[model samples]
Target: MGGGAWKRGGSSCRPTTTAVGEPVVLPTVTVEDVRRVGLPPSTANLQPAGGHVVLNVPVNVYAQAAPVTRQVEVLGFPVTIRATPEAFTWTFGDGGALGPTADPGAPYPAMSTTHTYTRPGTYPITLTTTYSAEYAIAGLPFQPVDGTVDVSAPAATVTAHEGTTVLVR
Candidate 1:
């Protein structure tokens, strides 16, 4: 194992293995570790600007998703963790929600993710981003981290208004 072992300071390091001969990576990267990195939350965006929309109509919504990479020490070993957006969940604040989907939606016209308001009122919009992570130790090949982490974006406010009919002479 001399040729394949990693050199740390002045000594050689090797991965431990279980009785069955499976490599047991020490300090395995976990969802908690990824969360501890405090990755940036995706920002929720809406079309039909000014925080207002028409009643009974579809409003466009999307997220500005960004991935994060960080370097940390796990049990004295240099570890690299990378978190990528894998899913998104949205709440329209009107008791309507869309979610856990791969599509982060798009701006007007694309209509990738839209919600229809049946009444005229004010609502708060929320988006939660789920990230899947992978980690590498000492420049070794990366390994998938079990489970995922969810980060909530800042809440946004929107008002849906009903149109009134007007007569012209």
Candidate 2:
């Protein structure tokens, strides 16, 4: 056993001591705390609205990113937690998926995230957002949360249609 500050099990907040032997307790927000804050999931959108796309064509996909803050009580202290989008994962519903990258993607003419479908079929698109959090207590500086929370947006279905070559006059 090491001799140092002893922390209570399952408690995220760390107890600190001031210069004058006074103990100051600051709340440490955890992943679960952020989840409890009921953060809103990013809105998943697809280009060419109505969920229709051309087969074998790159379809643009992006997620709306926003930071959310809420007040909650942790260890009997009022704490403010802010969760911000840090990464994203796009599932194209064809065994194809995009990474947990920082890119939140953009609309057409700036297609940061895109995927091409090989076959013509209906596919469901989903965006999973990873959020990084910070906590502020009693007018103190915001401290980073130890872990991140991943929230998946409601699935949007997209249909890919195969187009045939036609002779034009």
Candidate 3:
């Protein structure tokens, strides 16, 4: 009955709410969100634990990973995520493979995780590390996500030769 207001209930008791432009928009999460987390940088360190190893001898192979954790925003919420080295899989490149184990073999004396080469040859060793991921999103107690990702360390080269000892008189 007054300004450009619409009345309801067949009476001017209260005016209907007027449109106030478009509602504010908020960003939604997508696969691209993963890019923000990205694949973690190289974290594993792979190499032979001893200087020289003989054929049939268990050469100690070990890998280490750096600790990574950060609080990031995901789906417009604070998400705490952590990445840790879970296990390591080794490929001796000598037509043999080691383990996807959590054990990092000790030095020469103790071979916790090792491989025995049957013959003498130069080999390129590689170690692939699996990472365990844990995440907790703030305000979303029932929606927790967990997963694993793998990253490989730089390849290491090793030379293997038959054991020999010479004593001259």
Tell me which of candidates 2 and 3 scores higher on lDDT: 2
lDDT of each: 0.83, 0.82, 0.58
- What's the CA error at residue 77 for candidate 1, in Å? 1.6
Ranking by TM-score: 2, 1, 3
lDDT of 3 by residue, 1-169 (tens): 1123211112121232337844422223222232346545443333344335578766777665665666666435476656676777888888888777877555556667778888888887888877666554553332223446666777777777698676899
2 versus 3: better TM-score goes to: 2
Ranking by lDDT: 1, 2, 3
Model 1 has an lDDT value of 0.83
Model 2 over residues 110-131: C-alpha lDDT tens digits?
Answer: 9889999999899999999999
Report the alpha-carbon TM-score of model 3 versus the true structure: 0.62
Question: Which pairs of residues have clashing backbones in candidate 2?
Answer: none
Task: Indicate the worst ten consecutive residues by lDDT in candidate 2.
Answer: 1-10
Candidate 3 clash figure, as a count: 0
Task: Give the 10-residue window scoring lowest on summed lDDT in candidate 1.
Answer: 1-10
- Alpha-carbon error at 84 in model 3, in Å? 2.3
**How well is each residue in 78-135 modelled by candidate 1, as lDDT tens digits?**
8999999999999998899998899999887999899999888999999999999998
